[model samples]
Target: MDIKFSGVTKIFEPDIIALEDIYLQVDKGEFVYLVGETGSGKTTLMRCITREVVPTRGQISVGGNLLRKINRFDLALFRRDIGVVFQSFLLLPNLTAFENVAFVLEVMGLPPKEISERVSEVLKLVGIWRRRNLYPPQLSGGEQQRLAIARAIVNGPSLLIADEPTGNLDTHTADEIMQLILGINAAGTTVLMATHNQYLVDTYRHRVVEIHRGRVVRDEEQGRYELNGGC
Candidate 1:
């Protein structure tokens, strides 16, 4: 779970400079936030780490692979170290919640018996086992997001990365999602979240990496969200 980024930059053609010379690291089991206003390279940074898009320059090494250069052939092995949950929940609409989670294990070619057990465990951990038979449309926003979290973790990856995980939910639902994520971190999964929810920052007080423009402006241990009006 050693994630190290140094001098990383991503510039799309037509000159949209998303990130510039960014550097950061998160060791195993640390919960941290990448906070900023929209278009502040939060998603771009996540993409760079997960190798959805390559960095235009510099290096991003996670778990042992050089993300900038890993070929598609090697990607599956690389992804095995990390889990990602996006704001959209990204569940398969046709699959039941259990199957949505079970899909990951199936991809890894795990035995059905083990996959079933792990999926059950993760659903319970995310507080959605009772709803396992339900499809995406039948669940509430919070439940959908929880299912996303469950799906992300069912593989038991070393790092968990989430982006705007509760952006669409009501404050209470968002808080519940936050607590579930915090609980994941508490149970020894490293979480690196990209969020704009300042209240969650003040309330939970984890480490924070504040991204302004395209750079990491602050990396605070025991972080207190210093917004326009203080936290």
Candidate 2:
């Protein structure tokens, strides 16, 4: 899916600006990294894309659907095509790995056989198939992350939004998680990853969009974490 931000600006009450005159476009099948320091409006910009927080000014379109134009009835259907992975794996503690992924499909009213097949496929893809019976608390950090990833992709979303997906993991585990994400991107899922891992940003070498103080400072191809006097 493609994402376009046209002169997007966001401001909170009491005259606080979270984003200003931001213009960014991410094409389909592209993996772009959103980099900035803490409180730099990175999360707010992403929230605009998901329409969780409406922008104070300007417009955001995802996969050609204008966020402002989407009605309440269509919003749920629109979000089904978008997957979100958070820094904290928000898994259901009472549900096993298989049940977690299946829950998404079940809510969509898919047939039982198809849900089982799809859940199994994603679980194997994320390398958590053997532990499909384990609950969230029973799994290790990496395992839980894998389960989260599996659930996110099980719906075959066109766009994947990952906010600090590897933040809680160690270096080695982070690398493994990156590999899985990259593999997903390779298969034509547009990825928007907000992260602070400079090493991974430099090593992966994707397009980078850097924001500072609610403004876009840099957008570069094969970009690094640090730029000339930029974040």
Candidate 3:
């Protein structure tokens, strides 16, 4: 899905501005990295795309749908086409890996047979089929993350958003997770990832959008993690 933000600004009451006149465009099937320090509005930007928060000013258009124009009744329908992953993993402790992945389909009211097939397919795709019967507490950090990815993609979303997905993993495990994410992108899902890991950003060399103090500072294709004169 293509995303465009034009003159978008988000403000919190009592004089806090989370974003200021931001302009960005992400084409379909592109993998874009949102790089910034803590509280630099990266997460807020992702939230805008997900419609968790509306822009305080200007407009945001996702796949040609104007966010400001979407009614409350259609919000859930709009979100179904987008997938999101967070640093926390956010898996239910009581559910097995397979069940966790299947839960999304169930919520969407898919047929039982179809849910089984999709859950199985995604579990194997993320290389965690063997652990499908294990609960989240039983899996390693990397394994839990893989299961999270499986759940995120099980519904076949056209756009995927990952916020600091590798923040808690070691170098090797982080690399593995990134590889899985890249593989998902290669299979034609547009990915927008928010991250602060310089090594991963430099090594992967994707398009990078840098935000600082609620404003976009730099945007570069095949970009490295460079603070330079800008933050």
Candidate 4:
């Protein structure tokens, strides 16, 4: 999961520059935090890696795929190798937890038995196997978030992207969820997590990349949260 960003920039319009000439890298098996304030381009960087948005200039290579240069027709297969988790759970209100996990596998064209086995495995990995039959409406905030994590990793993606994953949870729940992410990282999924939690930023002390005003403001190993009264 080697990722390289070389002078990448994204401008939505004449005045709104989401990111500018960002150069960075994530070595294989490394865990990193992308930390910044609102609209600081953390999300933009993640989206660029995931191919959700196109870059205006420069280059980004994740694993072996040159995301910024890939053809539109080839994006889907590239996406399957990378997983993304968001602040919102994004669960289907009408679907059971089992169905939610199964849905991703189905789209990827796995066999029925394989999908069933994989769903059970990942839900348990996230500690939600018992709630597999429940709907999103029946779960707690943390539980819902865990379900989102389950869905993200069910396909066993080599690279994981989490954008403000704990934004919607309470403090204790946030801590637990962050722990879950770290545990996943420890198991060798190269992780790039975008967060605003200063407490979490201070606690983990992993590789940190800070963005400010659409630029890479700071990047450090085992970093602490600073600036704007954070940490």
Off by over 4 Å in 1: 227-231
The per-model lDDT (C-alpha) reads 0.87, 0.91, 0.91, 0.88
Q: CA shift at 151, candidate 3, in angstroms?
A: 1.1
lDDT of 2 by residue, 98-197 (tens): 9999999998889999999999999999999999998999999989988888888999999999988888789898999999999999999999999999
Candidates 1 and 3: which is better by lDDT? 3
Worst 10 residues of 1 by lDDT: 222-231
Predicted candidate 3 versus true structure: per-residue lDDT over 1-231, tens digit per residue: 999999999998978999999999999999999988889899999999999989999999998899999998677777888888976889999999999999999988999999999999999988999999999999999899898889989998889999998988899988988998998899899999999889999999899999998899999999988754363
Q: Output the worst ten-in-a-row residue range by lDDT, candidate 3.
A: 222-231
Q: Which tens-of-lDDT digit does each residue in 137-169 have in candidate 1?
A: 999989999999888888888899999898888
C-alpha RMSD of each candidate structure in angstroms:
2.2, 1.3, 1.3, 2.0
**Cα TM-score of candidate 1:** 0.94
TM-score of each: 0.94, 0.96, 0.96, 0.94
Candidates sorted by TM-score, best first = 2, 3, 1, 4
lDDT of 4 by residue, 1-231 (tens): 889999998999777999999999899889999988888888888988988888899999988888866887678888887778876778999999999989999989999999999999898888889999999999998899899988888988888899888887898999988888888888899999998888998988898888987798888899987854233
Per-candidate clashes come to 0, 0, 0, 0
